[model samples]
Structures are given as C-alpha cells and as structure tokens.
Target: MDNASAITVFTLSGLNGTEKYRIPLFVVTFLCYSLIWVANVIIIVTIIMDKNLHEPMYILLCNLCISGLFGTAGFYPKFLSDLLSSTHVISFPGCLLQGFVVHAYIGVDFSILLIMSLDRYVAICRPLVYHSVMTRQRVGLLVLYAWLLPATLVMVGSITTFILKLCDSHIPRLYCINYFVNKLACTASVANFIIPACTYTIYVCHFVIIFWSYFYLIRTCRQSKEKMSKFMQTCLPHLFCLKILGVSLLFDLMYIRFGSVDLPQGLQNFIAIEFLVVPPILNPVIYGMKLTQVRNRIAQLFGKRDPMPHKAEFLMVEFESSCPNPPQDPFEGTQHRHEGVSLNQDIIQAFSAAACLASGSRHGLIRLGGASSGSHTLFRHGEAVFKLKQQVSELLLF
Candidate 1:
C-alpha cells in the first residue's frame, strides 16, 4: 500500500498503436464531439422554449438528451487531446472524476429509460389516470431520482477507488472507468468488488422495471390499432434508444470483462468507446425526428411552416399524375363535384397524386391556365394557383 500510494498518474496505452492515422482520427473525434453538443443543446433549448412541448413526456425526453451530453463530456475532451498527443495519461484524481461522470451518466440514463417506459404504459393502458398520476411535481421527482440514485450508487464505487492504493499506473483502455480503476488497487477488498457488483445489479433492476411496463403496454395495445399507433408514434423512440444504449453498454461491459487480448486494437478501441460516441449524437436525433411534436417545433424554429394542419381528417392527401402533353382545356367542357366539393377545389387539392405541395407549404403556386384569386397556394416556388378551376370536368387521379 505504501509503494502504491506513491503513484499519482496513470498511463493509457489504448492509443499507443494509432500513430499512423492519429491526425484523421482526431479530426473525426472533434467533429463528433461538436455534433454531440449541438444536437443535445438543440433538444434542450427547443423543449425549454416551446410551450406546447411542456408535457411530462417531453420533459423526460429533455433529460435523456441531457444525460447524453453529460456522459460524452466526460470522455470526448480528454480523448481528443490524447489523440493528438504522444502520451495518453491522466492524473489519479482526474481518472476517478472521469469514472464518476461516465458511470453516473449511464446510471441516470437507465433510470430515465425506466421512467419513460412506465410513462408510456400509463399513458397507453391507464390514460384516464396518466395526468393525475404523472403531474409536473411527480415528474420533477422522477427527474430527481434519475439524477440522484445513480449518482449515489456510482459515487460509492468511485470513492472506494479513491482510497485504494493503486498498484498499477497503466490502464490498457482509452479512458478512466470505475471497473478499470478498481483493478489498480494493491489489495482488492471485498468492498472493492461488492460495491460495484451491487451498483450494477441495482441498475440492472431498472431494466426489469422497464420490461415490466412495456410488457403490459405491448399486450394492451395489441387489440386496438389506435393505441398501437400511439405506441408506435411515441414509445418507439424510447424503445429504440433503449436498444441503442443497451447494446452499446452491454458490448462495452462484455469487452471489458471478457474481451480477448488477441482482438485487433481498432475493434477494441471501438468497443471501449462506443457508449460515449454513439448515444450522445443519436439520442437527440431519434427523439427530435421520431416524435412528431419535436420535429414540427424544430421546423418552426428554422422558419419553415406546415401549410396543412396535422389532422388527416381535414386533409385530402390524394394525388394524380399530370399529362405529358395536353390540350389547353382537358377539363374545359365538364364541371364535376365530389360530395359538394367543387371540381375546382378538388383539383386544387387532390391534384395529380404525383405533384402536391411538399410539407403542405403554401409557397410554390402552381399555374394551370391563367391565375385565380384567393385560396390558391403554390406547391413549390411561387407559381400561380393551378388553373384547374378553369376546367374541372374529369381529372384522373388514382
């Protein structure tokens, strides 16, 4: 213990073999880190700023992005420096700090996922009670749990490493981790192994809670298409994120515990780093794009507008093909009405299934013959309203 206490720095050998392509790797790593910050900040700011997005579900989503940022911030900055420098090393105190940040980030993430799955279960299966049960105050508590539980649990493990007299100062991996740091202890106490074992076990129970919630959700939604649709629309992103985090973390844990030394350095590096690399960037994207409200809000934030309201009942999505070459008056002789909707309005809307306003933008007026006054919108660029109102006899749109 006396000899081990003398060591104050650790050497990371993970980047030792990357001398040939280190520059390119540094460039890519820097971009990935930059992207992680931008993506997460966009989600965080968008949710905070949008009033309609103040629901419990979106609130939980904001935390997911926050965890992604927290976890990656622990690893990326130091790693980018390691990529450019000759020595991949960290001080003993710095190593423990990294481990705590990484572990606590993952711990918070697991708790958040568990809460998200249960939120879906309630919203889908017991919707009558969802609001009463998951109020803003309750959601605040859940967010608190998401942050504190893992932090407390991971802190115990980090502290044990801090007190241990580290016998080895060389870490064979990319960055600091509790599991790896514990291996540095001169004499392994049962607390060294038991604290982490208990932490991992407790967090693994989060998975049990998640599965318990989703199992009922899937079964309940099986009989109702509407419920199923809601499940797909809302819960799919949560489940997809779970899969991503689960796979990446699981592979990383497995690699660290049982990975073969014979494996190539590149594959080993990827396995070790994927948890930090993939989730931060992907979490924001899936949540932002997969969930309708976030996607629409993002579009609005960028000055784009949706011309049509999202309700499909009000929208007639039918389209038709335009003729390659046509007589000036294809529908000149006939006037038709489908259920009191004039041929004029029908052609204007359910025109060729081929050409319609993209994103239902009011921009890009389509000119058919001459121009008409109001209620005419361009499908794209600012043409005129399609003159189909001039001749709406028999428009053929399948």
Candidate 2:
C-alpha cells in the first residue's frame, strides 16, 4: 500500500476551463472577497459597539457573520492566487487545513443558525423566560459551543483523512474538501464512512430543530398581530439565510455524490462553488436590510453623531413655556398683548435655532404671524420650519 506521506501535493482540476476568463474571474473574485469583509465587519462592529444589541439573537448573528468571514478566508485568498497561477496545486498540509476551515465554517454556520432559531423560539414562543433561558452566561456558552463543536468535528474529520493512504492525488473541485480527500484514499475505512454519516445525521437533527422552531413560531405568531410582526421582521431574515445556505449546500452535496460527467463543466463548477460565494454575500445584506435594529445601527455608524432631542423634548419645552397662564385670550386685552407677542417670539426663536442646528444650517429666523403685509414671508418661514422639523424627526428616528 502506498503511504499517505508519498503524496505531498494534490492537483485541483476545477480550474480546467478558467484560462479564457481568468482575469475577469480574478477581478470579480477580488471584489466579492472585499465586499464580504466589509459587510461582515460592519455587522460585527455594529453589534459589538451597541449595548442594546448584545442580546442572544444579535450575538448569534455576529458569530454567523464571523463564520462567513472565516470560511471565505479559507477559499478566496487561495482561489484568487490560483486564478493567476499556471499550476493549480495545494500542498498536503495546506489541503488538510483548507478542508478543516471550509468544513468547520459550514458546520459553524449550521450551528449558529440553529442557535438563532432556538433564540427566536424562546423570544417569540416563550417570551417571559427568554431572559432566564438565554442569559449572558448561557448565550456565551451557546456561542462557544456552536463554534467549538464544529471545529472539533472538522478537526477529527481532517485528522482521519490525514492518516489515510492515498492512491491518487487529484481533487476535482476548486478547493480542498474532506470528502474529496477521503475519496482519494487507497481503501475506504469503516471509520471514514461512519464518522461523516454520523456528522450528517447530527446536522440533520439541527435542520429538524430549525424547522420545528419555525413551525411553532409560525403557529404562535398567527394568533397575535404583535408576534406576527416580530416574526416577519426578525425570523424572516433567518429563514431566508437558512434557505440560501440549504440550497447551496444541497447543490454541492448532490453534485459531489451523484453528479454525472454529462453535465457541463461550467454548471458543475457553479454548483460546487455556490455555497462558498452566495451565503457570505447574502447573509449580511439580508440582515442589514431586514432587521430594523441592525439597519438603524449601521446607519448610525455611517451617519453623523449629533444628538437630536426627541419629540417629547420639544413638547416639554412647549409645556413649560405655556405653564404661566394669563388671560383666556391674550389678544382680548391690549394690556397683556405685548407679553403674548414676546412669548411667541421667544418660542419661534428657540425652535428656529434648534431647526438650524438639526439642519446643519444657519440662514434665517423662522418668523411667526406678524403683519398681513409680510404674510408671504411668514408662509415661507413656516414652510422652511416644517421641512426642518421633518428632517430632525427623521434623524431622531434613526
């Protein structure tokens, strides 16, 4: 039997037809990699900085984004370099390491999504005990378990493949996968079959948990509008993410196990790489757009940091100024008329100054009702104040 040590490198055949479009492919790959980093980093940072976002769902989401970054780092850099190279080969240790990272990435993704589903279930289905069930300590443990379990499983799988004697050193896909490495073994060990089968079965249970959580979530939400609204806003993004990952994984698994040579090489390649490309890009975009808190936090990160007072603040000031009541109708008597005009002027000046600051401009004062001759001027000032107030309100909302 030829020993595993004999094969120090494996040639990847996935780059077979990439020569004609290598440059274009490299450019696109580089851009996609950059985007994945930017998007994932933004989410991670947004979650980390905001104390309000330190909840279970957001924490799981942060880990999920980190997993995307981890998984892509395993593929894109090497793939980018391979695109520009003549020989597409990876050293044995490098191959094993890549397989470990890619596999761990996928496993962690499933784990985090599962945890997220459980989180949603608790938050929506069992709201009263969510805090007790998913406390800070427990959430930390869950996240740790999510990452650690996958890393341990993949590590064992990589080690199992590492010990095998190989008769061939060719990998059909663009990157190293443990299954492909196992295929290269001189003889299939029962452990190889059993371990992966068990791993798949375990993750299938995860899928079941996800589906079950969502089932109850859907059922519970239907009875109440508030729960239904929460489900649509938060749970939908998770479902979309799960669907995207599931489809990509299904294509890769199907093609790897039962794919025929009759299929086009391009289509085969696309199927193989879909999981690596789509999920990393799509997860952040979906969550950033769909989750209101995440969206607002992201906006706040890129937006200016001036604090705008709330609507209640404006109302409070109005309340305080009007507290000292005078006549029922100030304009009814000439004696109290000057005081009313002065009070009105003070209110207008204060609001105008606030509006100017909120608008980041200082042009003119917003005049109140003065004379019929200047009614047009007052109308114009009123319009500007209305627009300024709207802008301030929008800023405060974010």
Candidate 3:
C-alpha cells in the first residue's frame, strides 16, 4: 500500500451482502437500467421526429437525453454486471475509460443545461430576440462545443491522471469515477482535490449566477399580471429541471463534506455505484414526471390523445364571433342586392331624399359629390346607404 508498485488492479467489494435481498436488488437495478435506456432513447426520438418539439428548449433536451444515454451506457453495464455477480472489480483500462466517459458526459450535460437556461432566459425576457439570439447555427455550435470540449478535456485529464497513477490495481467502487479512482493513487496530492475543487467551484459560481438571473427573470415576468398564469406554466418545467439539478448538487456536496473521505477498499466501490449509477436512473424519472410536455408525449406514445386546447380555444372564439351582434337599428331594414349585391342607386337616392326631408332643413342635406368618373353626381345620404348595404352584403357573404 505504501509503494508505487503496490497495486496492479482495483477490487471492489460492493454493497454489504444481505443474503435475503440480493435477487431483489439485482432485479430492481436491472429494470431501472433498462427503463433509463428506453426512456432516454424515446426522448431523443421524440425530439427528432416531432416538429413541435424542435425548438431550442427541446434541442437542449435532446442533447441532455443523449448525454444521459451515454452516461448511463458507460457505467450501467459494468455496474449491472457487478450487481449480478455481487462482485466489484474493474480492470485498469476499463476504470480509466469509465472515468473518462463519466467526466465527458457529465461535463457536456452541465454545459448544455447552462445553455438551455440562457435560452429560456432569452425566450421569456427578450422573446423578440430569442430567434435571432438562438438561431439554429448558434445552437448547433453550442451543442458541438458542449459535447466536444468536455470529451477533449476529460480525455486529456484522464490520460494524464491514468499515466501518473503508480498502481495499476485498485478496486474501483462498483464502477469508476475520476475521483474515486484517483483516491487510490499512492502519489495523489492536495492537487487532485485542488484542481477539481477549482473546476467545480467555477461551475458552481456559474450556476449560482444563472439561478439569480432566472430569479430576476421570474420576478420581471410576474410584474405583468396578465401573464401571471402563463409565466407560471412556462417557469414550472424549467424550475423542475433546476430543482433536480440542485438536489443532485446537494447530494454530491453532502457526500463530499460529511461522508467518509478515506478511500476504504469496499466503500469506494459503493460510492461509485451510488454516485455514477443511481443519479442517471433518477434523472429521467424525476424530470419526466415533473415535465408535463414529456409526460404528455409519453402518453401520446402510449396511444392516449390529448385534446388540442388551442384549437378548441380558437373554435370558441370563432363561435362567439359568429354569434350575431345585438340588433343595432330596427329600421336598418333587410338589405337588397342589385347587380350582384351592388347598391341600388335609385332606391338609395329615394331613401336619401326621405331621410333629408324627415330630418328637417340641413345645410348638407343634399350635398352631392362627383363620382370617380367626374360625370355622375353622388348624393351624400345615398352614398351612406350604399356603403352600409355594401358592408352588410360583405358580412352576409362571409
């Protein structure tokens, strides 16, 4: 344990065996792993196939689903194997690869989540500029960077860390994480914790700022009483995502702060399984249940139909608009069509004369206007009746 050459491969003694519970544990974990895989795949597929879900928010979700898919795929197979066998041991190379993949996908997931938050911020606050700000090209670049940068950084870091390790044999917890595996190094120094602490702190600060900004955003939206309900509706889903993220962070911090730091042979493996394997399984279930859209989509996939609220609303508007306006004038009289609903010039002229006589001596009573042709005289009252008839005809026609 003291020398650089002391360990060649790590052995993991997983969860303390309670002989009565092994089969149930294996069955439960297996089903969870299977559900996670299938659910994430469905999410990805729905995002791709549904045009309604092709917006920036869903694009980010699809990226997250892909991240979770990879994250779970990277560790679950090994973890499941361990659960089945009740043995925890990972080869050196397998541990390194697992650590790298975990780091890469997790980094990518957070990076995308931050971008998604920004996307929501813009959509809610500066909706007019959201499209311009989150154009397809810009979002695509962010997605690429979210994935590639993390993969590259983790690859570089993992390779260097693996090379620096003095011992090849260290039993990783049920699976491997960078920190869990690094804990076994005879040469590990304060730098291991220091580097990760700084990196994690930077992300933590970013997350704090983003949450504060969203707080201001929610306040600003609430100021408009008209949008209060809609604001809540939109904010709820994002809030759920934030809550889950916060809960995960809380678990991580609590474990690091209060849980044992000592790298006991059996304990590291258990931590690995808890940290890497459990969270991924929880994500889709937590978010899926909290997000109405995802739940509705799932319901649809299961052949349940959600009545289109907007369409019904539109129909209601149309129906109300179709209801006849309260009768305006009793003498409005039934309109007659002449020359395919063109006004009846002779009749209008007659009515104009009667209206003028009945109204008494008016200065503009018989005011006549030249027609567009400059030859025909258009009587004022006649013109009024003519326009009224035209409007009535148009309305009826519609």
Candidate 4:
C-alpha cells in the first residue's frame, strides 16, 4: 500500500514459516483456548454463586478471570481462523479493533493487579479498619475504574494509530498490536510516540504501587507469625501471578521491538505469543489451588465431600443396636420405668464412647469408655435407676 488511505486489508506475514506445523498448531491452540474459557468460567461462577466468597479478595479474583477471558477473546478465535486459511488478512478497521481489544486487555490486567495490591495492603497493614476501608461501594468503583481507564487510554492509542499514513499493509505477527501497527506508518507522528509513552508511564506507576505494597506486606508479615501465614496464603498467589504476567509481557515487548532474524523462528514465535498462552490458563490454576476457600468450594461443587471417621459410624451402629425400639412412657408401669432407665444408660455410654473414639486418643478412650461401661452396668441393676430415669426425662423435656 502506498498510503494508509488506500489500504483496505493488511496481510499477516507471521505464519509464513510455520505452514507445515499448522495442523498441530491448530490442535494445540484449540485446546489452549478451550482451557482458558473453561478455567476462567469455573472461577467466575464459583465466586458468584458462593455468598461466603463475596469478600474483596474473591471479587477481585473474579475480575481478573474476567479480564483473562476478555483478553484471550481478541486473539484466539482470529488466530485459529488464520491457521486454516491460505491467505492471512484482516481489514484495516478490523486490525484497529483487534489492536484496541488486545491493548485494552493488557491495561485492564495491570489496573486490576494494582487494585488487588491496594486491597491486600489495606487488609494486611490496616486490618483493624479493613472493613471500613474496603467497603462494597469502594470496591465497585475501583473495579469500574480498572476497566474504564484502560479502555479509554487504549482507545486513544488505537485512534492515533488509525490516522497514521502507512507505507506497508503487511503485519509480521499472527495478531495485531498498536505498537506493531505504528511501525508500518510512512511517517512518525508526535501523538503516536507521546500517547504510548504516557500509557507506559501510567502502567509503570502501577508496577511501582504493586511493589511498594508488597514491601509493606513483607515487613508486616515478618513481625508476626499470624500475619506471615496470611501473607503466604494470599499474597504469594498474587505475586506468582504478577511474576508470570510480567515475564510474559517482557518477552513479548522485547521480541516485538528488537527481535532478530538470527534467532530461531520457533523461538521468536514462542516469545511473541507467550503472554496470550501462559497467563490465561495459569492464573486460574494457581489461584484455584492456592486459595483455600476457592479450592474447597471447587471440591464441594464437584461433589467431593470431606472424609468422615469410621469410628463415628461404628458408634451410631452400636447406639442403634442398643435402642432397637423407641422409648415407651416411663410413668406407665414399674417394668416400663426400669426398661427406660436401662436404655438411657446405654445411650449415654454409646455417646461417651463415640466422643472418645472421635478424638483418636487411645488413653482417653480406655478411661472414659471403661468408666461409662462400668457405671452403666452398676446403674442397670440398681433400685435407684428408676428415679434417675425420671430426672433424665424431665431434663430432656426442659
């Protein structure tokens, strides 16, 4: 294309050397995209359905997963289509839209991570006032800003790219990025450089805030065992997520800006697409396993019940055997009162045995069970057992 005004469609040159591997790549990409959708959807649904998980941490996690879904949607579907087609092309407007979505997705991720760090800082450092500080209204506003800020900034960047006069209509990547798109322009504009620089500066501030929060978190945790445990349980997962995303993004940025033909084609492709491949799938898996409540809720959702002791079952069986029939009125006759007392003693003995068994203490089981058994035997044949039965029935009524 001679000029941006004359360009209607842009040809993608990223797939030029990978034609032989397209089928295998298509299969792998399909599986990856499927996994991203399923994992993120599972987390989003789990958080929404479980009211007990409606705290700031889980709410932020849901937003993160939603961002993953949003970001991956921009690349995967179109990339899959390109894999099967001989000609890889996108319209001028389509490329701009894809660029906007992809960039906005990245911006939303950084923004959400920033908010999450702030939440953790307030929760761990200002625990006493966490509730007052992270109210429902405030979290809602923060989430709204997380999405809106990125969309607005990225939109401006996309518009700047859209107006640039281009000398080429060939993009070397499987997907669109504003940075890559700007490189095709015939002439550099001040707005192009200035807007992207400002965007990077804003996200760099996000990184600084995240690291600053972590520093305080580390210091607070070192002073107390309880705080340390909380930090490990919660903050470690966030840190892991930040590390994966940061490294992936770094690889992509470096590869796009300074990649060389000397590097292996496969290696360059891997570096270029690492961000889209790793974070979407890994984030949900990491959070699902590390967050105790989320893990337990997931287990419960899939009908995996916690293990119960066999001893409790044994105790129930013994109690049922001893009390074959429901108790009759103890006041009806002398024989009835005697039988009721005997049954009541067996029930108490059974309960005491179960308690000892559940505790899994051999010493306590021997002592408590032996005492209860002997006491039941002594009371079973005693003349005063009927009077004890009357008192027990009155207690049960009360």
Candidates in order have lDDT scores of 0.74, 0.76, 0.58, 0.74
Worst 10 residues of 1 by lDDT: 389-398
Please give the distance, in angstroms, between residue 327's alpha carbon in candidate 3 and its true position after superposition: 38
After superposition, candidate 4 runs with Cα above 4 Å error: 1-3, 307-398
lDDT of 1 by residue, 1-398 (tens): 67787999999989877899999998999998999999999999999998657777889999999898888889988998888788888999999999899999989888999999988887777764566788889999999999999999888887777888778898989988878878877787788878877887887788988999999989998987856887888889888889999999999988888989999989999999888888888889998888766887788889986564332112222222233332342332232223323333544444442133322334233423212212222233212223332122112110
Candidate 2, residues 1-398: lDDT per residue as tens digits?
Answer: 64565899999998897799999999999998999999999999999998767778888999999999999999999999999999999999999999989999999999999999998898777764566788899999999999999998888888888889998899988999988988888888888998898899999999999999999989999997856876888899999999999999998898788889788888988898898889999999999998766877787799944253222112211111121222232222121111122223434443544344234323233333222122212212235555434433322221
Clashing pairs in 4: none
Candidate with the greatest TM-score versus the true structure: 1
Q: After superposition, how far is residue 184 of candidate 4 from its true place, in Å?
A: 1.5
> Top lDDT: which candidate number?
2
Better of 1 and 4 by TM-score: 1
Q: Relative to the unseen true structure, what is the Cα RMSD of model 3?
A: 14.9
Cα lDDT tens digits for candidate 4, 1-398: 34557987899877888889999999999999999999999999999998767878889999999999998989999999999999999998899988888888888988988998998898777664566788899999999999999999998988888888888888877888888788888888999989988999999999999999999989988998956877887888899989999999998887777778688767877887788889889999999998866887788889985353111011111211122222432221112111223333544653333333333322221111122222222122122234333323222211
State candidate 2's TM-score: 0.77
What candidate 1 gets wrong by more than 4 Å, as runs, is 311-398
Superposed on all Cα atoms, the candidates' RMSDs to the truth, in angstroms, are: 13.8, 12.4, 14.9, 13.5
Write out the backbone clash pairs for model 1: 319-352, 319-353, 320-352, 320-353, 364-378, 364-379, 364-380, 364-381, 365-378, 368-387
- Provide TM-scores for the models: 0.78, 0.77, 0.69, 0.76
Error of 4 at 95 (Å): 0.6
